[model samples]
Target: MASSMLNGAEGLKLTGMRSPHGLGSMNSTLHGKPLSKMGLTPFNLRKDAKFVAPKCSLSSSRPASQPRFIQHKKEAFWFYRFLSIVYDHVINPGHWTEDMRDEALKPADLYSPRLKVVDVGGGTGFTTLGIVKHVDPKNVTIIDQSPHQLAKARQKEPLKECTIMEGDAEDLPFPTDSFDRYISAGSIEYWPEPQRGIREAYRVLRQGGVACVIGPVYPTFWLSRFFADMWMLFPKEEEYIEWFKNAGFKDVQLKRIGPKWYRGVRRHGLIMGCSVTGVKRQPGDSPLQLGPKAEDVERPVNPFSFLLRFVLGSIAATYFVLVPIYMWIKDQITPKGMPI
Candidate 1:
């Protein structure tokens, strides 16, 4: 048993494999085995707060030099982290959808009746279990930025089948057109250039791949769900639809999953964000081949959207006159250069 050293930057249980000396120990919560290159050790089981933006709202702006999202452990505790956590019921077949009632739910083949899923930013393995029963773990990849979270996943995760890859969403370390299905489950919303993450998903998806995205659950009020980096940026469905188009995904379906309340106590669940499921368009695919592009997506516009903004603009102006700034300063603290 080699000794493990904690990397201050990431609260992950880094093993020796990724270390230069190859002397680091495996993650504590993972399978109690030697780790490979900060390797994956699956175990399983388990497990957000108020994300307040300062003068500049989260989606409003951030320094280019800064990471899109910072997972500050101590401060992130109060977050409603349990939204992804569903314990004990993961192995139950009764919980599966009608399509998978008789058959195993395979995330890898989401459209083909199987499921090869990569749970991007999949923290705590809550959703993985939900996915595992529906699909084979071998077909699932739990990718996230935190080793600590991955460690927790290892404890309850189905190691024999599922995998844990540590990497960033904007610049994934996988080859292009890799996964059959992809999901963020409300995680990618934290990425700095959320578009990049969407593009990466598009890049690594097989033709006809389905990218199911779930952003934070919030009401219609813009500021109501305007959280910090954890729930910081929310990209327009158009942005994702555009990236998928550019990256070769067709049949893009963007639909919002609204919030669910329990007994009138607003449970911070999925709401007010769109779930985009797009199929990767292959070479020579026709312009009229598949689904609608982001620009073409149509929904009944809530007339009040225009009215509310108009009213807020008027009322806020009455109490305190203000002028919106068109030219904003870009932060250069973080690397904004193109990804490798």
Candidate 2:
């Protein structure tokens, strides 16, 4: 795909191919349901902060730079173990739909049956099923850390032809240049060092191969981070492009996928997704001419702000903590007079 094809929000303007999903028409209802149903709003109501250049500044205190909900290796293991039960039936459908997967796979041109593909962090094989739509299922491999999730994936008919393996995204078990296409979805947030994982994706793909990574976009508020960071990493648009380029991938472009379902109220922090695509270049090819270096958006440094965030996060956390207690109290108070 040419560089101009990824015109960001304008849409995938591929030449010679009049895609039913083309010309930024992926958002149109002709392709499927309304954007709201597919988990997209008409257009994001959030103000465009891209025009404002972020200032470079000195490092701040540890708490300021430190992300909330930082998970240790053990915490991640148990969290997914619990999540795997409800993941397929409850979680996967809300965000990553079949249409989103189609858009993510569009640039790869995977029509050839001979292409080898890998779905990194391919939990429950949701993404793997989508890959099989265009290419042979036997050509794909699904790698994830959770065996509980993998077991469910193995039971799916669409993924039966594919190979399943236990692996880490940052340190993949595959040899270098092993796959023609690399794709990951909804899993980047848990990566301890996401850039390292992106590098691994670049290392594993053959020259001119493409990788598509999908994840939640950064939420707008510190309070938002308190909720989201507990589960995933939400990198900004420029950060996604930067990670791909730094990993030596060419033609990096990012598209904001959706707000998903619509709400009547104009909410302060709307959730959006990002699909960042990049291609592996040939060994002797010239280095890609990258755009401006990514800038860090500065915020006011106040100890009181951190304290306030902690209190707010604590309150939210406490509310959930108190739910069972409240439920038990209600149960105790209510008289159970009828028994069969």
Candidate 3:
């Protein structure tokens, strides 16, 4: 653990990030949410002086740096824990719908009769549960980095064929072309090196294989260290498609699973995202490389969440903390454009 920390520190140092450890800590607390503006103290306000002035509009977006994947000896554990805690509180059986399961199952190419499926980021078998119900788990393996979270998932062992493997997403410990169908729900977004992981997925998938990655994107695009850290994961739609296709995924179709009966939990952070589906191209086939896809159609908030945010925003505004509290409440919910 100490060595890993040293490596993390060294990696931070290499990037020339100021107080990488501190930034990591702040990023950890922010989770997938952006920073709350109202929560800023006099000190934080002073720190943000460069942009807080009248001349700063915060209107124009700044250029985002392309990220190199972070290789950590330990697999990231926060996302798994986040799901565990979320399920603990809000198990809206309604939230887990057949449509989601059906849509989730759509990417299965059924490479073989045994159906060798690999489920990445199968926390508590949420995505795994949907897949097992739809196909043969006997040929399935759930790969995750956290033992504690995986163990919690293993307690039930709903299906005997569902095996769990502990490993990293960026550097998968598997042979190439080993899987027929690769489905990752709420997984790839967590990849510190998403491109590397995408390429790895391409390397492992058999020809004519289907690779569906449900990478996350926030509805809110901002400059908070909190937002930058995660937003870095959920790039624009084409950016995601290009990442996989560039890695050799053909017929790479990045679809937005929003609009129709979208999940309210998805737009937690004022930003909306889409579910991206890409397929590994057969050799010699020119992959689907197209111009930028349109953003998801406008979506209204769920009744419950909308009411809550309205109430909170109103209350916070009265207290002169509207921006901070509103952002906090927004971040507290799931991301918009409906991610899980």
Candidate 4:
């Protein structure tokens, strides 16, 4: 039989294979037999036997510069970092225009100069500028995480009076019940957790404070996939309602700010946008009803929208295609350079 020994000096177990004789030495044979006969495999235990570890490339172990998967806020932070330069001049003008901002702020009733307002994720001060138009700029606070975007906002002459701070929407750093009005626009699409951000809005708003959240509507499935590069979340109207109610908001109402069509079969603003407004009720007020109500959808009994689409389509085709063809035909028939 072979015996196993514990090499206390080296802190290693010397496992000896069973043989007809006794235990084998590390390099020598057991009794009169060789290591092979003793069924013992030789291990190179020499002090100078350098261990050659498997080659590990740093490239394989290192993390990537950009994230593998897109995170909403992180992607938006980087997106706006560069886009901030062209945001107000190029993007905001076409989409979230001054008219749209006015429409969003209509419900807030910012007429009172004493009303304190906070615009969460207010990048480039597009919405902030609108708020200050009604309320005093000194009473307004605009908070956003991207310094690049906020830097442009800070340079705005009107926004200079408003306080600008860097902060997150989901976890606002402000005190509870800090503002009388909360408004967020063109920013909710980038919220990683829309519900959490809304809750923060509620937390920072005082009793009877109005909170208005404006964002893009859920687009057609194909459109959603195409906009995947933008890393935006288009919430349906019901989602906005649910988010507000879940956050303990009262008097919650969903309003379709843009147009609708096809007897409400297709919403004109489905891809364009929508706004949800809710008021923080006083303690005694009743709880808000949870889902969207039937009246939320305004559907016309007649197929009037189809006619509207047809008329617009006809005008577009006539001006763009038919007009050019008619002009060419008229020139050919009239003869070259002849007024007659």
> Of the pair 1 and 4, which is ahead by TM-score?
4
Choose the strongest candidate by TM-score: 2
RMSD after CA superposition, every candidate: 22.0, 11.6, 18.2, 31.1
Q: Count clashes in each candidate, considering only residues at least 3 apart in sequence or on different chains.
A: 45, 4, 15, 0
Candidate 1 Cα deviation (angstroms), residue 190: 1.2
Q: How many clashing residue pairs, candidate 2?
A: 4
Compose the digit string of candidate 1's lDDT tens values, residues 1-340. 1111111112222121121111121223312422221121221111112111112222343322242222222112212233224312321111122222111122123443255778887776655765676577778899876666666688873654678877777667878767777777646545555555677777777776666665532222333333322233444333554555565554443332221111111112222233455556662222322232222113443556534433443342222111101000111232333210
Cα lDDT of candidate 1 equals: 0.42
Local accuracy by lDDT, each model:
0.42, 0.58, 0.46, 0.56
Give the residue spans of candidate 1 off by over 4 A: 1-115, 157-160, 217-219, 222-231, 262-272, 283-340
| Model 2 ranges off by over 4 Å | 1-70, 263-272, 284-340
lDDT of 1 at 21: 19
At residue 14, give the lDDT of candidate 4: 20
**Leading candidate by lDDT:** 2
Query: Candidate 3 on 234-332: residue-level lDDT in tens?
Result: 454435655765787644443333212332222322112334455555543233233321211134436564445344422321321122344435545
Give the distance in Å from residue 104's predicted Cα in candidate 4 to where it truly belongs: 1.4
- C-alpha-based local distance difference test score of model 4: 0.56
